[model samples]
Target: MKKQIALLLSLLLAPLVSAAPAPEREKAQPSAHHVAIGLPDWARGSTIYEINVRQFSATGKFSAVTADLPRLKALGVDVLWLMPIHPIGEVNRKGPLGSYYAAQDYLGVNPEFGTEQDLRDLVNAAHAQGQRVILDWVPNHVSPDNPLTKTHPEFFWRDEQGNLTPPHGTDWTDVVQFDFRVPALLDYQADVLLHWVKNFGIDGFRCDVAWGLPTPFWNEVVRRVRAVKPDALFLAEAELPQQQVAAFNLSYGFDLHHAMNQIAQCKRSASALDEAYAKIHAHFPRGAALMVFTSSHDENSWAGTEFERMGAGYAPFAVLTFLLDGVPMIYNGQEAGLDRRLEFFQRDPIVWPAETHPTTRLYQVMTKLRREHPALHTGSPMRRLDTTDNATFYALERTAADGRRVVGLFNLTAKDAKADLFDPALAGEWRDAFTGETVKLDALVPLDLKAWRYRVLVK
Candidate 1:
């Protein structure tokens, strides 16, 4: 009887011992895997989309945009960044339509876009769809006839001649710069930002020309904004080292973006992207997130559309943006592969060029992979692995907790390239992220890349 009882105990203990080596055990231990690091409660694993309200739809109203919340949510977008919706100043406007940055009134919504009630409804609709809305805030300058100028002329930045000056070097006669030296100016601006958060439940702000403002002012503004919305995400439009000190959650990855564009245009080789990627890790402080993208409002309008800038390299470059560190973004009409550069200060709309261009399929696949893989999500640092094919192809590895590793290989040229891959740390059979096939690491991976094609493998 004693032997039988001992045998039963041994049988029960054996299963628990075997199950103890499960995924949960590895998660508890300290890890070398860059993925599985937690983002702040507010912005972890979140992706943003820039909304060009003026050209998103025919009427260019918030109500129309509100109706598309389900569509955007389905696309895996977490935050919606709306360009300035405030009233555009009529005097000294840029063109027939006027710049959105030129604000006539700070308090009122632009009637052209929608009414105050319409905007409130839009916010409500977005919230219902599990999406947060952030407004594009122009802190450095305001319309020449802004209410602040009329009420307090002393608030504006003045030159040696005591005349209101434009920000930086510009032909922007329609807007005047603000002097951050005045504490009252900061207070007023902070109060305005808080009003939106407090009244309408705005999730956050995408500060325009953020590098132009004083660091101290931004620190104060961030504090003030948080006092109302504790978990607000501040997206700085400019890429400045001091922005991290000001508690900004993210800044533009301009250096990396510039390099990627150069490679796409055939001005630089694939090695250029490696250098750019290295610089970002060197310059940006730890926990400082950079916003990565192929197209944003500034690049789309001033420079060129993605098709023009990236050309044949668009798909592979996009794959990099999605799988690499930092949050990826899709500008309005980007997923639909909008070809033309919409006029900045005009009513030019995207004609849905996806049917002909067929780039949406690439974006969808990348976005899906990003959503499914922890190795591709935020907090994972991309490490460039040694590759035999240097000129036309490169390889990178991203490891997550639980020993899951993803290897990404890119062939930037228009011909077949072979890659010799070796990593002792990588284990198990790897599967292709796009094609969903097993990849063998024992031999050279022959890739027949058509210009911008890329392959991402996961274990």
Candidate 2:
């Protein structure tokens, strides 16, 4: 039996690296052609909250997250994106705890986090609160110590000496690349994805390095998964436009995120946001959802916290993430005003403040604005209104189909500035989103904005 298994592995790995024939449904789908997928109705006005389970609490357990669901629901989180829950591979691990991306088993829950029952309880609790849960799934690679390396050696890419290799052009020596050329590997991956949806009742997945895999694989996976759960949501951790075509409902808005950073540091003007939006509009298909944010796990651990990167302009940028024509995401601890970079490989829990932080209130206001106003929902029409000082002042109006309107004015610089907001669209009675004061805007209204201040006017 052992000799026969070895021979089977050799046969599977003999072919040159190439994508297997796409599933029958993908036969007519061109690689570059994009067709916008229908988004789940529940996500139309939803906000995503990313959870770093390892650093979310002192215990770093699923039970801890379960205990905090009420607070998250009150914070207006609609989707809870949990980081990988699989056991980490020990061989060639980066630090004492190892990277969460280094999966030792696809089917096993990490004991460090909790038992499988614990994860199920967390998902059930989230579902009871009307919040969707998506697991972070790494498809491009796996830890060298993964069980598949021994049970199905042909599933991995090997060097000339038949040694498993890391992904090309990266120092990620801990994880070995997967060979999607083998048809059976795709079947295995699909089964693993279905297992979670069927058993644990996870809503969908947030695929890591989604761009690394072939589009055909995603198309097939989406078809298979949705066959079971039609409303499953797929979020690609990439900005590639093609990924949104019939596979993923949302993709990361990295370009806009970078533009926000540049504007905050004065390396670019507020007009840079316009440029970024133009590119996004030109590239992505209409009705495609984009997830926009100022900070994430990668930004917090490798780059810096939003406080360190955006400095005084952090609040304004956070406001933009909500106001923009995309779904907004809040990284864990962001509401608590987490200032320091988190250790990626060690046990470093977020230090939550005893009292509610001011940032929490800011988020509450923004989230309330998002939930209550259809005009601010994803896929709503957003028009950039011209201002006198386009370099420092950014103004835009979002209008929903039902005639509701929300206008935002942002001072993207550190210096106080005044600009004339003159547009027929700006003529209306508006209430402040933060303060309840009412104001009227007429033709050519002159506005003085303090450094890094932002105003959200609802009509």
Candidate 3:
């Protein structure tokens, strides 16, 4: 009777176990629309260098930047992204100098930075050196004292008392938000963009707070601008996937940047990078370009310098920015190891060192490698190679259509770690980018990396 009871219980459980459904796999969420924009030929393999004009030199003038063109060319810079060049509003200003994003005029140059012709000459000089120039454009808002506030009151958003307001959910009191619902405002902004491209000969624009505007506005503006300059580049400060659909050629890699910071602080492991990349691949279109960087204007001023946040992991993370399948950027004072938080709304200029900094060589080598190897360019295919220590060691291989290949090995921890990379595809003779030594890999390659060490090999 006991044996009979046990058989009956097992029979009842077998059907329930078989009837249970399998767990569903996670799926990637792609953008609503397909990306229609193509990157300009000039930007495919290029690197961007941002210049905070207000803090770049003691004079903080366009002439100073113009004078540095030759040096920039020698440093392997292909694009110069100048921070806002318009006059800052005096009313409700943040500091003595005011915020650079608070524009007073769309078509006028800041007297503090010199005359309009000074900017024209700077653009001309950069173009002569085979470098492209992009302006940081503030379209979402303008200074409270801007002429538009009085002249075209319809272009602004107002509260119940009919008073202009700042951008929603922020403490940016110096500037008033724009009302994109007004058709004329769109037309005026479109014209403003065209004016720079036509008059100043600017290669493109870096749209500030781009996510605040509607996508259709950017689509229409890009359509109108491309009608004038077919290869004009547009970079969006936002990370929205839709921004790259038909407007921006590049968007910020905010997720990846944050992941790097987290990993550096030991709050997360190197595997966090893989998760970040997976999300990026899932959300963005196949060929969308992202700008990878360790530091930027906002990051340097508000949060902290790279050294403060990333500490000893700074150099290795910088190497990852260049090796990854995206266009890399170098902030103005990064090469000189600027470690202090620059005053955002003041006249704190960067002090120059008489001798060349070691970081300059690191950036030069990285940029040179990008120029020589199409495999390192944006839109190239990247494959992750499995390693013995996946949590701390990260390795990847990128290959271009022209059969060129490059590999990067990074140890994202602060302790000694060894990883035996296992990838049959890695079997080849490669040249070391830094030491100029030859490395031959078979089916397996053992890497003994010190804390925060990295290696770049080209084939």
Candidate 4:
């Protein structure tokens, strides 16, 4: 696995290393408000949790997840992004269960999952606990067996012989691509997006492969969906220059995630994270929120779990995302430290760790601090602090609008590190977030940290 990862990253970075240092990300200019998505009051500092109902529990059903709402609420999650709930097409399926993205019908519920009423019950239950639910949407493609293939053939592409083909350049044979040029097609999709809010009262959508489709289509969908559900939020699967203005409230921070991984694997210095964050903040539109994470469905299934890729750094990175800017996401079983490569197209249930486990406790503590600390909110003012070992140690200080302050530090290498940090602006007494002890930062303080360890001090 180590060799495979080394080869993969080498290929991905070969071109990047040869290229000149990228120009700093460009600041977005003003654009029309048609594609703008409004932020809700509850989401300003809230965290998101991703759930694949099929693998969430032993039953692999909606009831299993609904039953666990209180526990999730305790974990400090504000929104639940459920994987696609539509029925999977039987034709040309990849595995016995099939890929979740190959939707057979937009409006139909997968019996393998549960009934529409079951989903409605789940949503109602989540709302009762003060949490919102968003469905994962697949707008770029559909299973060949989908009704759109027959009802509106013009909605999809065709070859010289008039045969529908898979999305360009991939081995995804189970699904066919949709052409975004059709006005009627996009109009129909806008309705499909509203169906959840109009009937089941779903809070929003997490658009899959959002960058693969056209920007105008998203603009239209956003305009139509928010017409009635003004508080609904949108999370795009990919980040693009125009995606922030194209209608998403948040998008994946792929650049930052990759850089962090490289740092953990010893391919890059700890300061690489600072470079990645700076570039994304500069490029994304004003007020745009980036989603930072250590693991996800794709990362777990394809690359490896955080355990394999980050190893000892998993705990530190997990804590870092919670204390830093941008929103944090907890993929199912992440709190329990899932260690296997979950099968994407098959029946693979996650074996959660015992309740008293350290990972679970760490998530519980970090998430509570994430919810309670105003200093940790997205868009809060932050500055990088100088550290003794610039190559392996990272340190930062953040200040919230309410005057709350927090200082965070991490040792990103495989060796013990002593990073010295102090700032007159932060001179004062402080309380450790993980421990109840109080310490003074009035003078230059030396942090003796273990490899892949992180410390957070809140005031």
Question: Which candidate has the top score in TM-score?
Answer: 2
Ranking according to TM-score, highest score first: 2, 3, 4, 1
Please identify which of the two predictions, 2 or 4, would achieve the higher lDDT against the true structure: 2
Per-residue C-alpha lDDT of model 3 across residues 291-351, encoded as one tens digit per residue: 9999999999998999999999999988888888888999998988888999999889998
Model 4 residue 422 distance off true place after TM-score fit, in angstroms: 2.8
Rate residue 1 of model 1 by lDDT: 100
Between candidates 1 and 4, which one is better according to lDDT? Answer: 4
Query: Which regions of candidate 4 are displaced past 4 Å?
Result: 1-38
| TM-score of structure candidate 2 | 0.94
RMSD of each: 19.8, 4.0, 15.7, 10.7
**Which candidate, 3 or 4, would have the higher lDDT against the true structure?**
3
In model 2, pairs of residues that clash are none
Residue 12 of model 4: what lDDT? 74
Model 3 clash pairs are: none
Give the per-residue lDDT of model 1 (tens digit) for 1-459: 999999999787442222211111111112122222123554555678899899998788898798878777777777899999899987788888899999887778999898889999999998887788999889888988787876766577666555666775677888987766667888898998998998888898899878777667888888888877777888887776555654587888888799888888777778887786666555556666778899888889989988899887777887788777888888989778777788989898766543534556666666666766777767766788766766677677876766576787788765666666565655457888767889765544444555567778888
Q: What is the C-alpha lDDT of each candidate?
A: 0.76, 0.89, 0.88, 0.83
- Greater TM-score among 2 and 3 belongs to 2
Better of 3 and 4 by TM-score: 3
Tens-digit lDDT track for model 4 on 36-68?
343566776788999988899888899889999
Residue 4 C-alpha lDDT in model 1: 100
Q: Report the number of clashing residue pairs per model.
A: 0, 0, 0, 0
What is the full ranking by lDDT, best candidate first? 2, 3, 4, 1
